[model samples]
Target: MSELRDTELSAKVKGIEVTVTFPLAHGKPFHAKQAPETTVGTVRSEAMSQFGIQEEANSTYYLTHGGSRVDDGATLASIAGESEAVKFTLVKELVQG
Candidate 1:
């Protein structure tokens, strides 16, 4: 008396390597494996967790690669392409009232 469900997809997601760097003293960059469809915000959250950074409502962060800003909504695959590892800098944005 068991029911069966179909779970199959034609397309598969690939894992991408990413490294995040922080500007704080003694801050070291860390590497993480993520799917190509993963968003920048997800990566930022991981970094924050790894670094033990407390989340602030008024403060914000930005991810940059090669001196270019990466949008939070952008996917890792779109930014890294076929590279072995994508380098990203986590910069804290100054909030103005």
Candidate 2:
């Protein structure tokens, strides 16, 4: 059987949209059914790995889904209040290759 993953997801909290992205190996597709129920931090770590981001940069990521948006600096309470885990399509600068 093939492995499953949750590559992307979105949540709407307080009328805002929050998008999440997870990393998959180059040329290896995600198995949607097997993805974990992750949090905002999880998404960021995935992006960091995919982009070769060093820990010192402390870069912020932007998330968008439907009509809502969230930044990496957003508080967990804020995100939890407005979003839910749902399948989404991920598009990241580093994942382009």
Candidate 3:
């Protein structure tokens, strides 16, 4: 997805849409219209649900945007910046000593 281009999602929210994909999940990308203040953690949880992922014993799920790990506390607005759409890839990180 690209910038809204005058396509208003909501009057109160200049919404930015987020799409998340997992290479190993064997599923389609998860898409959502996110408010500016929505947190990455919240999106991660939603993505997990969409992908039917359950908590694993030693694996952690993280999101990467532009090939960089994104902090859970980061807001979608921050990631999108002047754009209205952002894409993320969900990665499974195994705990390693």
TM-scores of the models, in the order given: 0.77, 0.31, 0.83
Q: Candidate 1, which ten residues in sequence have the lowest lDDT sum?
A: 1-10
lDDT of 3 at 29: 93
lDDT of 3 by residue, 1-97 (tens): 2236222323334888899999988768999998877889999999999999977888999999999999998777667776778999999999775
Instruction: Write model 1 residue lDDT over 1-97, tens digit each, in one string.
Output: 0111111110233577889999872667778988776788899888878877867777788789999889888777677665546889988876776
Each candidate: what lDDT? Answer: 0.74, 0.39, 0.82
Candidate with maximal TM-score = 3
Candidate 1 Cα misplacement greater than 4 A, ranges: 1-13
Models, CA RMSD each:
8.0, 12.0, 5.7
State the weakest 10-residue window (summed lDDT) of model 2: 1-10
TM-score, structure 2 vs. true: 0.31
Candidate 3 global Cα RMSD: 5.7
Question: In candidate 3, what residue range of length 10 has the lowest lDDT sum?
Answer: 1-10
Candidates 2 and 3 compared: the better one by lDDT is: 3
